[model samples]
Target: MKWKVVVMLGAALTLFGCSKPDAEPTESELSNHQSQQVVIVHGLGRSAWSMQTMSDLISKQGYQVCVVDYPTLRQSIDNTLGESASAISNCLSQFEEADFVHTNQSKTHFVGHSLGGLVIRSYLANHPDFVSSKEMGEVVFLGTPNHGSDVADYFVNNGLLSLLGETATSLTTDPNSFPNSLPQPNYEFGVIAGTQSYPVFSGMFDNSNDGLVSVESTKLEGMKDFVEVDIKHDKLRRDPYVTRLILSFISTGTFDAS
Candidate 1:
């Protein structure tokens, strides 16, 4: 009788231990459960404020957003890369603050527009320490000139290209420089292209372009997904459709144009 009672007690204990539910997630875990930091870099001649709308939208979905501001026209690619890296470090520091304040330590995601995309690519390629293959979640490019821009050539002859310094030539005439700066598609990345052309610059492109870069040129080698928006080049950054596509890509590794 004593032995049977002991066996029954042991069996009851085992069932209780197995049936106990997991504790509820802490405040920090709840906040960072589906949370991630998004760093937005603007294109040439554009300030960090250019990405404000996108940042706000993402923030509404429980993400911390940082829009990096740098002197786009005053420096070469090397100098710009240095400044951009510093900005990225600063954004990470802000995450540390969030950890201290809210007790959440989440990873970061990078999203760049036009020349800014190139800057992120160059920085990631050159400075592997800042972002490791495992640490990086996703990278999104908006109207990035992966294959250089013909408009840059026109701007160079017209003297407007001086504002962009070495960046203009690096993307246009000096193909070897900027092309080599980017890392191969070893990680997950998405590219968004603009198909609508502004009337004034329609004659500039060979065929279909956003007045600056061609749709074909935006098709990079390592990109996991590619999308085309009917909006013009300048307006592509602000399109709601583009924003939805970007959000979809970030959440899932794939994006559909429709």
Candidate 2:
């Protein structure tokens, strides 16, 4: 099997594989392989479709993949966390219930993009035990607002933008908002930020940003590793470099960083 590598160069992210794939293994051949599952949650205003590409590539690596969907545009993170947790649980439960794969050391990884990252954080905060029970692995946040999004505050202040509803307003990095209330990640995790910004919302950020989320905003207190890619916020999930970086981290527990 070939293991991929994620490397950080000046101002950009690059991905290169370290080895070549050998012959494909049969079911019997993989029977002893450590089973793993990856759960992908899409960001605000998006659906599972947005994460399908990442899911497919992960599945090609022989891990089971689950793409979770929710009403991110209408429901607040508070309301969506439980549902996302349930969906992820259901996905992991299939392997256990069917006995198709060994559960003794089964591992589960979580991936979220943008607001989807916050949803995962909220889920963990609310259901701390799920980590140990599921043999939890590392988490990867792509362009997520760990602190909060200034664009969110910008939109909330504009009366017309409020029509987008709670989902839109809830992301503000207000002193007393949901994002600020959450605890730092207890499990291994890394955040990938986009150095490029969308020209339209670029003015909303006080510092370097990925259109909606500032690089500073994507940072959490105890992140295992951090790196910036030239990709944009919404496109981070699908960007080849970003996706390969995700694969590298989930498999190795680390990605190259400056």
Candidate 3:
């Protein structure tokens, strides 16, 4: 019943949310980040609108930001990857058009929330020709289930996951699930997990969680840095302090407060 409530709330928010992206970076802001870009991706069952806050905050930091829109409702991760990659390519093309990529040698960074992180991982793995590690700037994952999620496992066992789509099944805690199958990133990347959880669902996880994903599930081997924020799963993308950490990690390799 609780999981159903969570799902319904997430659905309603995704459908009726009034999120709007902030304006493009100002001339002064662009002067500093002219050769840098950040692409943000939202979580499962959410759209680009869900990431407007992140886009706005990072754009203020001077990086051109793109919030990717993917068909996340009922599609397999593999099925949706091409669309995700295409959106990334289209965003990056702007840098090329402006000569920042060739003349200034721009770097592209990624910021993903929950399922969005996995989308970036899969995109880089499957499309190696797109960008090399040297050209890839830092990546930041906010509450992504890098090791898969038990909440997904629960839904799968009860046969209710089909209602959410194949990606739900792929996100289960099984060793072979999509998130588990992805290789560890070979680029500069950081992980930020949330310690806060909804009281009703906190008991479901053995460790700290963000209501939807356990802190343990958000980790991966060889991450450059890792930190925890006091926020829930749905709020990680908008929390100001977490945004500061994201900016810190992007500007510097460590999330150590500046």
TM-scores, in order shown?
A: 0.79, 0.83, 0.86
Off by over 4 Å in 3: 1-30, 99-105, 130-133
lDDT scores for all predictions?
Answer: 0.68, 0.71, 0.78
Question: What does candidate 3's lDDT look like per residue over 142-243, in tens digits?
Answer: 999898876677667777767777876688789888898898887889999988887656656888888778899999888999998888888888877787
Q: What tens-digit string does per-residue lDDT give for candidate 2 at 108-170?
A: 888989877888887877777876675787899888888888776765665433555576567
* lDDT computed for candidate 1: 0.68
Full ranking by lDDT: 3, 2, 1
- The positional error of residue 14 in candidate 2, measured at the CA in angstroms, is 26
- Candidate with best lDDT: 3
Name model 1 segments beyond 4 Å from true.
Answer: 1-34, 100-105, 177-180, 256-258
Candidate 3 lands at a TM-score of: 0.86
Clash count in backbone of candidate 1: 0
How big is the positional error of residue 34 in model 3, measured in Å on the Cα after superposition? 2.0
Query: Which window of 10 residues has the lowest lDDT sum in candidate 3?
Result: 12-21
